[model samples]
Target: MPRTILILNGHPDPSGKGLCHALGEAYAEGARTAGHEVRRLDVASLDFDFLRSQAAFESEAPPPTIIAAQADVLWANHLVVIFPLWLGDMPAMLKAFFEQVLRPGFAFSYRPRGFPVMHLKGRSARIIVTMGMPALVYRWYYQAHGLKNLARNVLGFVGFAPVRDTIVGSVATRGRESIGRVLEKVRELGRRAV
Candidate 1:
């Protein structure tokens, strides 16, 4: 069956030349080839302020860009977030994008007591992280903490189910052939709508 998929290019650079950009394009290409509806959100191209206080986070109206991004999030059945790992975490722009878009009443609602209510229960997510280190080293030695936090803490907390991830490490050293293989694998993932 066809799915509504949103591919979020989370790279901080807006030049459309990064590996993350290529990966996102490849995914969208494969998805469209497989008969799926695909949408894209480029974080670098958006203009929005970062939330600085709890009151702002909970009550302030998001900017127009954020509102539009939230609409895309709400429209999709599946989400693909692609970013380059920086300082052991997602780019600051991507983090800000999440902060601005996943506002209260959109992603969840707070209760006087107990856990916040999740409004996005039916959706699914996949996070793809490109990094400078070996994938296994990031997974085992570093414990893949950043990836886990996004997949479980943020997405899962907002009710995204079965959140999965692809870690493409040693990106700086991968040759053309190696990168091509990775792109093919990601394309296959897109074809499967995973």
Candidate 2:
């Protein structure tokens, strides 16, 4: 079956040729070749302010950029987020983008008695992270805390089920052949719509 795939190029750098950008393009290419609809958002090019207060977070209207982004989120069945791990976590702009788009009432709503009501229950996500460290070190020694936080605390909290991830490590040092293999692997994932 065909799926609607939203590829978020989350690198803070605006360059279109970075590893994250290449990976996102690869995913979109494979998805399109397989007849899946694909849309992409380059986070670095978007303009939006950070949520600084509880009032702003709870009640403020989102910027136009965010409103469109939310619409994209709503339109897609599968989301592919590609970013470079910075200081062990996602770039601040990408995090802020999430804060803007996944606002209250859009992503979830609080319940008086217990857990918040999730609005995105039928969606799924794939997070791809590029980092300077070895993948095993980030997953094992570091416990992949940042990745887990985004996957479980944020995406899962909002109702995206079976959130998955691809961690590409030693990115800066990877040879062209290795990078090509990684890109091919990501493309296959896109082809499968998983």
Candidate 3:
């Protein structure tokens, strides 16, 4: 069945020629070829305050861009996020974007007891991350900390299930051939609407 997909380019680079951006485009292309509806959000192009004060969090009204992003999230059956890892975490802007868009009430709401009910259920997600170190080293040595944080903590917390990831590492050392192979793999994933 054809599904609605949202591709979020989280690289914080508006020029859109880096590995992360390329991967995002490849995925979008594949998804479109597979007859899925696709929408894209490049974080760098979004005009919004990245700094979220406590008051902002408490407020019901978020910035206009954030509201729009939340609507996108609600619209998508699947989400694909492509970003480069810097210093073992997502870029500050990407992290801040998540903080703003996945706000309370939109992503989740508290219960009288126990965990909050997840409002964004019935959605799945895939995370494609590029990094400087080898992929295995990042997975084994660093315990895939960043992926775990996003897949388990953030996305899962919001009720995005079956969150999977692809870690493309040694990006700085990889040649065009290797990068092209990675892009193809990402495209295949998109083709399946994964």
Candidate 4:
């Protein structure tokens, strides 16, 4: 059956057109071509403080819009995350979205013993990350695949199954052929995504 996908674009500069856009464009087109319904949530366009006020988190109220976004997260069958890796990890807003949207009672449940448990089962995800650093150096020095653990452990803890991680490495300055190669890979990933 065709699935419904939620595409989360985490890049601040939508028009910059690098590996980040490569991830977003690929998955959006790929899911569409595969006959899946796609809904996009671009982080850069959303307004609101990335930090929920201390009072809001502690007591009476959090933003209603955040509640709404959580509802959307629940609706998606396939979650596709596209982003650029900055300072060895996800952009702040992207991280903040998880902090805000993936709430305690929504994305997961906790065992009475105090650990969080997965709840959003029956769904799957793909996280595609673009990095400016070379893959090897990033992995060796900076632990590039830590994002994979975020997707696999954190998001997976929220119940997404079979979470796939794609890293488009070495995105700093590139020659024409190299740029073309990355774009080609993006297209290929899109075509293969189902």
TM-score of 2: 0.98
| Better-scoring candidate (TM-score), 1 or 4 | 1
lDDT of 1 by residue, 61-89 (tens): 99999999999999999999999989999
lDDT of 3 by residue, 1-194 (tens): 99999999998878978788889889999999999999999999888786547767756587788889989999999999989998999999999999888877789887899998899899999999999999999999999898899998899999999999999989889988998899899999999999
What is the C-alpha local distance difference test score of each model?
0.93, 0.93, 0.91, 0.73
**Per-candidate alpha-carbon RMSD to the true structure:** 0.7, 0.7, 1.1, 2.6
Q: What is the TM-score of each candidate against the true structure?
A: 0.98, 0.98, 0.97, 0.84
lDDT-superior candidate, 2 or 4 = 2
The sequence of per-residue lDDT tens digits that candidate 4 reaches over residues 1-194 is: 67778888888764645567656776778767867777888777766466656555434344776776777788888788888887778888888777777766677766879657777888888887777777777767766666866776678878888888777776776777887777667666565653
Q: Which residue pairs in candidate 4 have backbone atoms (N, alpha carbon, C) closer than 3 angstroms, thus clashing?
A: none
lDDT of 2 at 8: 94
- Whose TM-score is higher: candidate 3's or candidate 4's? 3
Minimum summed lDDT over a 10-residue window in model 2 is located at 10-19
